[model samples]
Target: MFVLNTFDIGECLSFLCFISVSLIFCFFMLFASSVLGGKSLSRYKHTPFESGIDPVGDTSLHFSIKFYLVAMFFVIFDVESLYLYVWSVSIIETAWKGFIEAFIFILFLLLSLFYLIRIKALNWVHK
Candidate 1:
């Protein structure tokens, strides 16, 4: 049913040429860097560098559970905001049904937030 025209063929060939050229350039750069870059490794080069700060006593540190809980709550709310944006964009098409659903979603989020607060999930000093 469909046929490729001369212009389409030209465009496809141009795309292929561009892709091939890009791949060749990337390969050449990688090869050149591996052969020429980073000569003579030293002990100082291998050491961990933190903003020119010397290596500290301990690298491992314990994080508070409240920090993780707050992070998770932030992520959950951020993702819900994305969904709300999508729903808002399609609000006209979805009409009344979309409005009610979005309202219910917001209500649930609020309830969950209240529950978390009531359970002291966000409290840092209490723990």
Candidate 2:
């Protein structure tokens, strides 16, 4: 049988204790809310409010594809920035090879951006 070291056993106990405390707290909150919360149902409270503006027009308006393209570009660049951040954090360990790799990565990003600009993918108003 594999025996856990004291530190490992302590960690396990602490984790279990944390889980138990969380469960107890969650159960207590649920019970208290059920017993003490009000049950008021008003028409004004039921209607959805948007920045204090009442529902005015049709909710299902068609969105421009450019909006979706912008969102996708934002996500792609955001993830690339994350990779750059991690690479920057470990720059010293990665040295010249990492520098070359990051340069290539950035080159690709710039090329993609230029392509998008050339295709007018970033343009809000279509010609």
**lDDT per residue (tens digit) for residues 3-120 in model 2:** 6554677878999999999999999999999999988888897877999989998878898888898899999999999999999999999999999999999999999999999988
Question: Candidate 1: what lDDT?
Answer: 0.91
Candidate 1's TM-score reads 0.64
User: Number of clashes in model 2?
Assistant: 0
- Candidate 1 lDDT tens digits, 20-90: 99999999999999999978778797889999989979888999787888899999999999999999999
Native-referenced Cα lDDT, model 2: 0.92
Span of ten consecutive residues with least summed lDDT in model 2: 1-10
Worst 10 residues of 1 by lDDT: 1-10
The CA root-mean-square deviation of candidate 1, after full C-alpha superposition on the true structure, stands at 5.9
lDDT of each: 0.91, 0.92
Top candidate (lDDT): 2
